[model samples]
Target: MPTVPRLACLLLVAVVAGCAGTDTSAPSASNEAETEYDAATVENMREGTYNDAFESSYEPLPATPTLIQDATIMTAAGEPLENGDLLMRGREVDTLGTDLPVPNGAQVVNGSGMYVTPGLIDSHSHLGVSATPQVGPHYDNNEVGMATPGLWMEHGVWPQGPGFARALAGGTTTALLLSGSGDLIEGRGFTAKLIPARTPQSMKFPDAPGTLKMACGENPKGGSGFPTTRMGTANGLRSTFLDAQDYRERWDAWLADPTGAPPERDLGMETLAQVLRGDMLVQVHCYRADDMTTIMEIAQEFAFDIRSFHHAVEAYKIRDRLAEADISASMWSNWWGFKMEAFDGIPENVPLVHAAGARAIVHSDDDLEIQRLHHEAAKALRAGREAGLDISRNEALRWITANPAWALGIQDRVGTLEPGKNADVVLWTGDPFSVYTKAQRVWMDGALVYDRTDPDRQPRSDFELGGPRQH
Candidate 1:
């Protein structure tokens, strides 16, 4: 079985690489100068503006031209405001009050009986990798090497992927593109805004910090033949971080003496160095309690941050510790029992984490589930309510909205509808918590991206290009 998973992953990477047209060579460094570089310079060496990553088809629409009024707005901050009005302009929120100026020629969307709020954000997702039923080469979420810290998930993204369309229509405006969980150190994941375009770059959230995906527990160790145990996963994660720490020090020493020359740049080490230097966020996948605790300890040892814990089914057991560490729990609502480690999962995990004052994020690990993230959030809220926790619908909405936005390190840009924030908003036919609720209209960067009534707003991937329009 382990060999089967490994072979599947290998074939997936090969297929994805072939479809991508060409493989970008990893940056090389000489061992002779593999020491003595400044921290800033070493950091600079790792960060480069890639023209390919920025390519996208999304265009921003007039911000001040759309007005949604007379709706109950769940701010995801405190309370729901009845008769609230949200005005957007040029990719940012211009106003969010009952009394607001309506610019001339603005598209006044009648929200008389609707609900409006921040667009949903999925902090943990493998949509671009394992999109739908198309397995094999279409799925390259994990790298083959155990030390593939240098791998970037964005490069593997199938821009024409149909998964993005479904997520956008389902009301998710932003998502963190993560590599698969086949490896302990999966690779780099970036926060992306779901905008229709020709490339992934066009879809990425501008200025969002890059994140590294790490895993602990069964996915990393218990997979038939690899680590084969919990302790093995811990060792892999710890060793990687430790190496990163060393890499940072070597580069720092070299930088102190520029004339001496810089150290050799190993792609893997360079990636880990970025984390040690706080240039990247750490996203870990773990389901069991002991594993989670082990991860926290490793993070402390290296003094690196763990941005969020994804698929944390047993998170409720350590709610206080998670809160104290300021770690966010990016979790599934009802997903569990599919594997042995996840057997202890309880639906109340999210609510319990939130009640303890820790950040709680709801994410779509599945393509179908990604479309209905709001419903998943609703389920989590219901579970909490059943557990006697004081959770409001508006607060629960944050699981898919503001909370995730924060976890992805893009809160400053698109999480909330505050002035100066990106105008990524969703309009629903009813309370999003209700199963009957559906997104009537969606906007990203003040541009109308999806509208239930507008056929053009509906996205069609390259794969479906020649196929008959489903409509």
Candidate 2:
């Protein structure tokens, strides 16, 4: 017999040791059968392959103690610092101050005219699943059902998609790659560090919180499934949540007793159950204010929080309410009028929400748009300033950095140039808000991933008038 897998051996040992105490009642025919099944369930749970599977295997790239000197630093946590030195030791920001002493054995780069900020984040994106070549076979964003809480978006992610490299070159380090909202419940979203890897597992951010993708407006209803109308969609979702509650109760009862087999496993219901139990965050794709209100009511009934709403064009109308509930509005800067529900999109949506004391995230749902997320945030910042909101450049930068990081549940790890945070940072050639600026260098987890000055490190398709950046 082949040696038992390490996990299996440990699980077997636990089972033999009666960790939960195998049923001790007199073993009648039915009792024995139930006890055996219960033991098997416990073993599978311990193995972790039967449930809560596909754990991340991500490892940070090799890094060195490096200092980027004399740059304008926007931390996204406070006012910008001028002529500051940022030191990255190992995989985290070691220090940020003016005239910092260079650490021993640290490589130093002069960043005289560059601006450094936390790498941009897109809270709502479909980069890997939408695929770069844009062919039918490459497109794996949407599945065929309206109720597909069972499907996980990472399974469909094309790791080789060229978009990941392009996104990194554009200064985006982390992105929440969501399932296409073609289904009412398009399933779970995957948060990834934009690393070029062979599989999504390698790109997965370790210990990142999970999120589910749901839709309340036009996108989901277009599918040929149970929910063809908005009312139908609402009822369908409510019904699913009710079923998830029942499933959770069943599982809970088994854990409380462990005398019999647990309820039959359900791929779809299990995901919804995780949502109900608060193990997963829920982000919805909604445009109209009324539709968002409806989802809010459902959330209240279900006793779970809505993390954010993607493509919420009319989020401005309910900005106060959203702020009160602490729900983030992940939106495009100004792209609107392509559909009926999205027509109300105003350029000032992000800042208006921010002014109301709510988190406002600027996200890119399109592949091309993902590359210019900072530009999108800049546009919104200008619009908000023009509207007299008194927003600062640092605060506007948070729309693309800190706010989106919070939405994706990775704010503590990234979103700011602070000590004890991962060095996912971008060095820009000019003012990051200016259209003329380009990302001069990027470092993810302290590893220099892109350097525009180094032809070997730059992306091949970085696309200037010349083969390489002339500016």
Candidate 3:
């Protein structure tokens, strides 16, 4: 699992606590004045505890530490393990072998004849801001500018949006919150923990590297009175990336020698520099296979990675190249015929990608469909079988879990029920692949964030006044 630096973690905690009330700024290098808060005055504030051995000893055993035993573990690798035991502690997998010693404080959850995999991760979603479109203040997705790579998508995220809750109920734990496709260089996309909290800060993952959300083709060009050709879209993206390259060089020079006043910081340039430095990932929304190749070739020219191609309906045509490039394809199970460009899409798209040994993901771009991504994967699996392509049920499960996690650059942290990883797990009532299977419990960071068995545990947005009823 990727580890966030200690300093970054401390800064994040301080930023979150500052939301309560305070200056929130850290002490400076020159004038380090100590500020104190009176404990007696703050009666509700609890004492803080420090554990030097948190990683080794401070295993966060769940309030009801459930031990799931004798299950068909779809490790999302190659084969399923028969009769496996997964020891979940706090928000991570404490143990995942056979016939191990169950801890004293653990509650056993009988998992005989059940399937276990990681919670699904959606690589592409416009759920929260596009949730039925009530009004302006309620909608904060997709900035209108042509180039806004520096902007953070989380700032515009509506924490209480119904989509977040619905996705969780559907078995998604981690999601990449993205800006809508309004510009060629759409702003940043950040990974978020799908849990209900009072603030967005409470839900943002601590160390998930921010990614730049870029697009090609019709969405960016010819919206009203602009570049109506494919050349325009390609050129626009090229110009932005080239500028980003220059911006990175300037920042590096400034960082090397602080001789003069630093150049005024541009949020877009700062984010682009992260991409140039290979710190941030890139998620491009392109439909045609040719466009995918074009953007990827440009990425090679710029010397950065194209993490995943979102909505690549024609990806099956270029599955060999995608595998060679080591890029994942996030596509709908069989969604096609919506537009002329996407008319060539086929049900075999995912299966072809899988057959070519490339990452195939089934993502829900729609708010309603996102809740059943597992079923979507199953549909694709059947489609592949009908096409005479052999795809295992365990590998099909990766369409949502391991594949999407790998796409968003977070597979190591929460992708599988691997030991020494975050306990972000989901327990299904029956076979997860079956249509009747539903996520009974969803745990994030070892906390029972979503429990279908509990009425009050489900998340309800404050803005869901006249919205549709949720499960």
Candidate 4:
């Protein structure tokens, strides 16, 4: 027989010992002991301390009250304002309007003829985990196993990746770093603020919901042995969820009566159980429309909601269904024909989804693409206009800003220029939809993180210190 893991063995022993205790009907201290034990167990389950070992250690930088005057402001929440002033009072937007009085001792910026908008947010990225220079050891975004829900994107995030600086330069202040779609259930993804730091945890978005990175269709089916076909993929997912349900039931039983001993902790099942409990968001990499519909069916079967579908090339075909389910689509602007499933992709996919009353976002799965997400959104906007769709510059900007933040479950904090939201603002050289425009200045939590005019403000990874290299 195979040897049991140490924790499992210990739990088995505890169960046997607890079962050997004498039964007592009297309402004595024994009943109180049981009640206290049950309460502790329930607390443990609710707090989810088992997964807290990788909690975020991020702390916002010291805020400086600053004011930008006479600039066009695209709030991403409404229409654009002309010659507006934005005040950032210590890590949050204080006010935004015309000719706002500068506070005492506030740093002032003359934003004449410039544009201000919320920092761009990428719904799908593999920056830190994949790393720059593209070497074997740096490719930690995927694992070999087919079912490895125990892995987390944060553990593999290399904080020194040069791509992070490039993304920041492009006004990408927040991003969702996801695991590669090489497995049926790859792992958990993480939301992070683009703050330069020594550790990944220091850059994590505080209190953001955990995201499970799942894959369907060609990617997971091609290499993984068991899930060789579409039907097999569905079956595999169903079976895994079924096992997770059983695991959750066992733990619930043990928690109801702690004297009977606790169930052995299974990390993979624990992650899935969080999904079942609606504590974690599910982001799947799906391509075809049929496959996406099937995945929705599976989600219904498992009684969980899919937050968004990454690289959903055919999402336009099922936009109504997605809207009804309240599922968002994180898609590329114009990529297609590289694979069989992506053959039916259209340039107007984003606008079509938006027209259907669904949340549509433009995402970058490639490192180079992440830096120009605004340009990608622009391309989709133009495509929509050419197709006779009524798309505006402000609405198109939401494809990169507010929409992605909603998909990542961080819209309440960093997606808009609201007074109570974080001061993740970017000043642009011109119209952000134009190719000639660039991010002149970028701020995160009211701190000047990047300035195009000052070389000192630009952060470079330690790896880029010795020689000139391409990021």
Please tell me which model should have the higher lDDT, number 1 or number 4.
4
Model 3 poorest ten-residue lDDT run:
46-55
TM-score of each: 0.87, 0.89, 0.82, 0.90
Off by over 4 Å in 4: 1-44, 50-52, 254-260, 467-471
Residue 439, model 3: lDDT of 83
> Which one wins on TM-score?
4
Q: Model 1, residue 259: what's the lDDT?
A: 44
Question: What are the lDDT figures for the candidates, one per model?
Answer: 0.81, 0.86, 0.77, 0.89
Q: lDDT tens string, model 4, 248-326?
A: 7787676656663367788889889889888899999999999999999999998999999999999999999999999
Position 280, candidate 4: lDDT: 90
lDDT of 1 by residue, 220-275 (tens): 67465557777777777777777778888987676556645456877777778778
TM-score computed on alpha carbons, candidate 1: 0.87
Evaluate model 2: give its TM-score: 0.89
Model 2: which residue pairs collide? none
The parts of candidate 3 lying over 4 Å away from their true place are 1-64, 132-137, 464-471
Cα lDDT of candidate 3 equals 0.77
